[model samples]
Target: MKLGIIKLSVLITSVLLLAFQPAGKKPIKVYLIGDSTMSIKDTRKYPETGWGMPFAHFFDEKVAVDNRAKNGRSTKTFLSENLWQPVLNQLKEGDWVFIQFGHNDESPEKVGRYTTPTEYKTNLTRYITESRSKGANPVLLTPVARRSFDASGKIQETHGEYSDLARAVAREQQVPLIDMDKKTQQLLQEFGPEHSKLLFLQLKPGEHPNYPNGVDDNTHFSELGARLVAQLVLAEVKAQNLPLAERIYKPDPK
Candidate 1:
């Protein structure tokens, strides 16, 4: 009888300890949906990194950054191609979807991808509505700026109507807005015309094997530029006091 009593006591203790153990935390996911500026690059595009790549590492392990941003997808194509559906299906409560699509949408010259301002607003609204329906928060971001400067060394607004449309959607939907276009343009202005080249894919011929003829791309970002841009986004996240900011990886004090 004493042996049986001791066995029962052990079992009870075990159960109590197990019950008191801290529950494992469910990871929060932050989805990034945008264009080449935020998409992951191929190994061949080595020094040319995307802001999403660096943004992924800025968060703690409890926050998973899933970058769904592609090379040339506008909001219209992303929806029609069924890219947004998968993300919609996977979304759970408290997950975040960062939606940014203006570059390709603004390119009226590209008939295949040109999304009119009305269509842009409608698409953005659909994203916000659907994401909310699934209990996920959707953040709208304007397109990142291109490194364009007039001869007078002043930065230009390249996004035009699309940026304004994104702002309008954010306001209508009450979603968080990150004006990446304006922010990046400010960053470029600070660097000036000549110095800003360091932030882009400005390669000299024969300098890198990937681009034998060299590249003078002002749209795509170099690794340094991508990180800086990611930092800007992170700063905005903190400034906006988004719940995900709590998951950002902060170093311990020395």
Candidate 2:
């Protein structure tokens, strides 16, 4: 009887302690939806990296960054195809969705992917509204600027009108906006016209097996470029004083 009483008392104490224990923080998911700039690269792509891939490491375990951005997707194509719906289905309260689309959407020459200016705004509005409906917060981001320099040796504005539309939607919806276009332009300019080439997938012939012939693409990013851009976004999160900023872990030195 004495042993039974002791066990019962211990069990009751344990139960009471557990009952009074603080609940753990709820898991939050920050979804990244965009184009090649933020998409994950295949293993075969090697040095080609996406800002989203590195962006994931910026946070504590409480936050998960889902990179739903694809290589060649535009706002129109993302909506028209089977992408957005899957993400929408999984959204929970306190989740965040970052939507950035402009590169392919502005490229009318790319058949089936180009979204007109009106359609672009409509698509952005739909994403924002739908995310809010699901009790999720939505942030709008202008597409990261491409590395382009004019003869005057100044960084060129590449995202252009589509970026403007993104800004407009953010204002109309009162959503958090990360103007990556401007931020990256500043980054490139800081590196200057000559040094900015290091940020993109620029390679000489036989530099790597993937691009044996060489590539001069400025839209996509190298591994260094991706990591830097990801850091830029993280800084913006803190600059905007986002709730998730509090959860950012200590970043790696390298």
Candidate 3:
């Protein structure tokens, strides 16, 4: 009888301990560090959608995506703007940050903002080191594909040298890489330039070039496009075998 009683107590203790163990579902925090392609939105009626908008949907409620990305920003400018500090300060172990830039980082006027191949890789290394120091993992993403096309119906990669630099950064850092530029290019080829244009934010008549008729569009994506890119990102995470990705993908229940 005493042994039975002791066994019962042990069982009870085990059950209680199990119950109190922080729900294995501790939120997996995520921070997005990128350019207009990944920027979070405001109420102001901008026609284009940033990929960050839909990325949050890929994960279960246990994951929080804090998109600190901005429009017309680059790796250098993002730091100059002091955006990384806020995310870095709050980052905890097991958290992840996605860094994608290079869109606006290619122009001559943007030289200070555009990191050359060597400098770009250096910046990425710093991000990785800093994030790791803060107990966060950094994921590098290549820039999104541009709308430029060739007569053969090819979606030209306009980012050029920057795209190569991004790939090198990922390789050198030994970080998970989502080749957004390459993936986007392939997807655009499947879409064809004319139809792919649907993915970009369209502008009304007589807007500025960036606004595309002053209507606000072109470089940015739409909600649907963002969601598609998010899906692709998930796929990339799986391909790269990142641990945090498992939190986002689970078998569907009947």
Candidate 4:
């Protein structure tokens, strides 16, 4: 009888331990919705890396950054591809959806994907609404500036109307905005025109990185450049009063 009682007590203890074990923690999901500049590309032939590749390092492992961004995809085309649909479905409360487009959005040369400011703003609004409906916060990012320079060594603002439109949409939707175009332009201005080329992938003699016949490309960036842009984005997240960002950065030493 005593042995049976001890066996029953052992069973009870095992059951209690199993019941009190803590549940596995869930990862914080961050969905990156953008274009080529923000997507990972096959760089075997090219020496360029997308900013999105390094962006994940800005956050901890608890934060899962799903880079849904693709090459040559505009805001309109990304949606048409049904990329956002799956992201929305998987998203839970407190997740963030970062939308950065406009590189191709303003390319009137590509009418099928090019969008006017009015249409761009409208599409951004819809994205914001959909994200909110799914209990996820939407953050808008202005397109990063291409490494274009003027005669006086000033970095030109290539985004123009599209950047303004993105800002307006962010304001209307009450979302956080990362003005990467302006920030990058300012950085390039500080570096001067010729010197700023260091951030881009330059081709050497008989060395064709992305293009053949020795290209003079200035649009894409190298790994270091991508990391710097990602750092800027992290800084912007801290500046924008995003709750999740608070843990990522320490107090400024200044």
Candidate 5:
């Protein structure tokens, strides 16, 4: 009878200990760092959405997508403005950092934002190294494509060497890479040029309250475009079989 009581107590103690064990489902944060293509737009901007905005919804409650990308910023400006420090400070193990750039970085015309190819590579390396130092995973994505088409309506490669440089860094650092530039180019090709305009901020005059006269911006994405890109990223995440993929929100088929 005493042995039975002792065994019962031991079992209770074991259950108690197991109950107090640290939870394996601790919430994770995915930090998005880059340019306007991925930044959250102001409410006034309405339909002009950023892919990161829609991306925030793809994960379950156990994940938080913190998009730190800003308009007209590049690797150079993002670091110089001290944007990366706050993210670095908050990083924890099992977190992720998705880094995408180019756009303004490739344009020498953009005085403050242009990051030379060498500097771009160095900056990407720094992001990878620093992110890894925190035990966080770092993903490098070549910038998404700009809307451009040739006479035959074939989408052209707009990122050029910057995308290649990003690829080189990913290869050398052994980081996960989502080739968004190539992926987005294919997406555009699938949509074709005229239909592709549906993905951009192509509003007619007086169509939207904000852009009263109308806007024909190609770099930023419309609502449909943003959601599509976000879905594409999620698909790539699943394809890569990332740990975070398990947190992706899966709806009931029923």
Candidate 6:
């Protein structure tokens, strides 16, 4: 009887220990929805990297970064093409959605993508509302600044009313706002006109095989520029004390 009792006690102890074991950490996902500036670049694009590419590496394994941003996609096209639905479907409770769409929306030349200020505000609100409904947080970011400079070398405001619209939406919805446009413009100003060229897709003729005639695009980011911009966004995340900040990859003490 004593032997049987001892066996029973051991079994009970094992069960108790198993029951008290620590649970595994739940995985958190961050969904990025924006334009080409934040989208992954094609292999042919080479040095024209996007900020989202490096943004994914800043997080720990427990965090998943799903960048669904596409090239030339404005708020209207993003929704019209039903891209947002897939993201909404996959979002679990506690997920985060970063919404940035103003570059293409503000271009009057692009009639199809151009969204009026009212429509832009409504679109942003819809994204925030849907995200909240799914128990997910939505962060609004103004479009990253274009590298435009006047003859006097002052940074120009390229986004116009769209950036303000995003700010208004963030205010109305009580959502977190990252003024990427302002931040990047400040970065450009500090770099000055000549030096700022390094941050963009400026290339000499035949310098890169991708563009034999060479390219001098200022709006797109080079690899270095993309990484810098991603770092800026990460800094904002930390400054805001966002929940995702906890998943940031920090180095162990030396």
Model 4 pairs whose backbones collide: none
- Clashing residue pairs in candidate 5 are none
Alpha-carbon local distance difference test for all models: 0.93, 0.93, 0.81, 0.83, 0.94, 0.94
Question: Model 3, poorest ten-residue lDDT window?
Answer: 208-217
**Tens-place lDDT digits, model 2, residues 1-254:** 99999999999999999999999778999999999999999988878898999999988888899999998999988988889999999999999999999999998799999999999999999999999999999999999999889999999898789999999999999999999999999999999987888889999999999988999989999999999999998899899998878889976799
Q: Each prediction's TM-score against the native?
A: 0.93, 0.94, 0.84, 0.85, 0.92, 0.92
Tens digits of per-residue lDDT, candidate 5, 1-254, equal: 99999999999999999999997777999999999989999999988999999999988888999999999989999999999999999999999999999998899999988999999999999999999999999999999998999999999999899999999999999999999999999999999989999999999999999999999988899999999999989999999998888999998899
| Global local distance difference test of model 6 | 0.94
Error of 3 at 29 (Å): 0.8
lDDT, candidate 4, 2-90, per-residue tens = 99999999999999999999964456788998898888879574568788889887766578889999888888888888987888889
Between 1 and 5, whose lDDT is larger? Answer: 5
Candidate 6 lDDT by residue in tens digits, 1-254: 99999999999999999999998667999999999999999989988998999999998888999999999999999999999999999989999999999989998899799998999999999999999999999999999999999999999999988999999999999999999999999999999999998988899999999988889988889998999999999999999998888889997899
Regions of candidate 6 where Cα sits further than 4 Å from its true position: 1-22
Whole-structure CA lDDT of model 2: 0.93
| Candidate 1 lDDT, 125-165, residue by residue in tens | 99999999999999999999999999999999999989999
User: How high is the lDDT of residue 198 in model 1?
Assistant: 94
Residue 194 in model 5: shift from native, Å?
Answer: 0.6
Error of 2 at 171 (Å): 0.4
- Cα lDDT for residue 106, model 1? 92
Clashes of each: 0, 0, 6, 0, 0, 0
